[model samples]
Target: MSEKNRDGKRSARERLAAERAKQNRAEKRRRGLIVGAAVVGVLGLAAVIGVIAAGTGGDDGEASGPVVAPSGAQGEDSLAIPVGEESARSTLTIWEDFRCPACKSFEQAYSPVIHELTDAGQLKVEYHLATIIDGNMGGTGSANAANAAACAQDAGKFVPYHDVLFENQPAETDDAYAQDATLFELAGKVEGLDTQAFRECVEEGTHDGWVEKSNEAFRSGGFSGTPTVLLDGTNIYQDRSMTPAKLKQLVEEANQ
Candidate 1:
């Protein structure tokens, strides 16, 4: 072989080796990132579990608020009140924090229309209670409100109490539900909801664990905030342009 030809071959071999080294490093970085993300995801899940466990296993004395799972809930982590026909064509899953002002606003703006659809058997609503504000604002009001709502459910009055609670939701920062008589007082607005049993359920903080679990489910649902409304698994408020008429239209489209 000629000297120039030999040199050219050697240069080509070097370039090939360099390219292989680059590819190897890139592959390693990609795998490292994946592992890092896995670890982060695991940690995030653990944190959620811890929060949920706080409701059932942690020291009751240390609990920031009341904690008890509601009886007859759909599951340990969910309390569903069907607001329409059993075989309704559409299901609206609502994840809401009672102390969230935005949720209250959404209720005030769209609840009337929601009622119309549900009453007509065009839609069913599955309400999921969450306590994002309690976690964020460091209080027990959200949990209390959720628990009271669940207690009302126990009395077969979930729908009415649900309406009344949102109708009376305090400012996000008010934490008004934490006050001693507030939850029961809200119940008074819902006929037949304020009674000895209902008062015990509210005062004793019956269903707090369910509230925590529901909030945990909300966190696990991969949603961004409270008042997360989903229509057949599609997020309806991703753009946040909310109106009762628009909601009715969405349900009609879904039904069609």
Candidate 2:
């Protein structure tokens, strides 16, 4: 072959190689973009699902049945404990696990009534945190969060923290209940909590004993599931569907 023809052929080969390399780089960039988009979509979907699950009540899945006060309850008035009448008649104690989804549902469902009652002095609700669901879902049960909540309670910030945790419950997965740095981060979002004190308590498991004792008493009282509500220490109702009307009815019936 002529020298000029050989040079032209070599140039053509080099140009082809360069073109192929450019195409390969473009393809790689496209693939990376696709993967990144998929990841973002999945994360966004997860956030949506978590929000819906947290907000929605799980009545169908709850272990407790429909709301029905015990028979022969002497009209709903029996349930009303007069507001601020604390002569052994003002307190309605509840034992619940933070990790228990049912407990979350119960809180969402009945918290309004409890709040109204508390505000009106018709009821004084004492919530005893339990950790019974910790081991059940392959995550840290309610113990860690409960302990932190108790610490917040000591700081007069329990209800706010409680609402935030319930509102931000992790999805039900292997790590759903794992207490970690994120929990402390969540606690920090609660207004008025001393972040340092809350973190210290969570790390040391300060309220572990309180949770333990509450669980022991709950078990002794025959509560196999979370969110067991008691009227004046008596096991009168055990339903996940304890709505405001039902709670009010029970309260009125009990007070009579």
Candidate 3:
């Protein structure tokens, strides 16, 4: 080959080698990113577990009294009131306060889709009650209402009674829920929920300690505020673009 042709061929070979090296470096970077991401995910999950364990382990001794979790409550420390089929493929965890207007708004906006998804056996909800409003607004309404809901859970009418509470939710400052009568009257809206046992449970605040404990869990979990909603462990409510329709789509995709 001529000298010129030799140089051209050598340049072509050099270009090919450079391209291969670049590709190799890119692959290595991609692999590193994936491994780093996996480590971060694992650490995040471990942190969540640690928070939950610490919150409910009762080491703080803040929520005084017996931790009387409601019957049928599930999950860590029996703090979750589960709604929907257990076999559902996806789980939506909600941390809410009965006295929270934002929580009421959340229920109004998403309960329909939630009900539809639960009814279709595509999703299950683990409701975690919080009493942040009581502390923030200075009243026991949050705790009282949550106890009543737990009583309703005992009667197997929690869903309807829960909706009833939100539908009849009083103003943030009213503290109307502080009265056992108000809770009972609301429970009356749900058939079979206003039984004598439920009445006594609400009147006596049967699950007050449990509600307090759950609220402690919420506080210690590093959550921002009420209606902290999570879909399959992701904080979906924090996503400003989220909507009921989008939630439905996500649940459906997860099922698929």
* lDDT digits (tens) for residues 28-50 of candidate 2: 99999999999999999999998
Q: Report the lDDT tens digits of candidate 3 across residue range 186-215.
A: 877887777899989988888888988898
**Compared to the true structure, candidate 3 yields what TM-score?**
0.76
Clashes, model 3: 0
**Model 1 lDDT per residue over 126-151, tens place:** 88888888877878898888888888
TM-score order, best first, reads: 3, 1, 2
Worst 10-residue lDDT window for candidate 3 reads: 54-63
CA lDDT for candidate 3: 0.91
Regions of model 1 farther than 4 Å from truth: 1-72, 75-77, 240-242
Go through the candidates in order and give each one's C-alpha lDDT.
0.80, 0.64, 0.91
lDDT of 1 at 197: 95
Give candidate 3's error at residue 146 in angstroms: 0.5
In model 2, where do residues sit more than 4 Å from their true spots? 1-88, 174-177, 233-236, 239-242, 249-256
Best by lDDT: 3
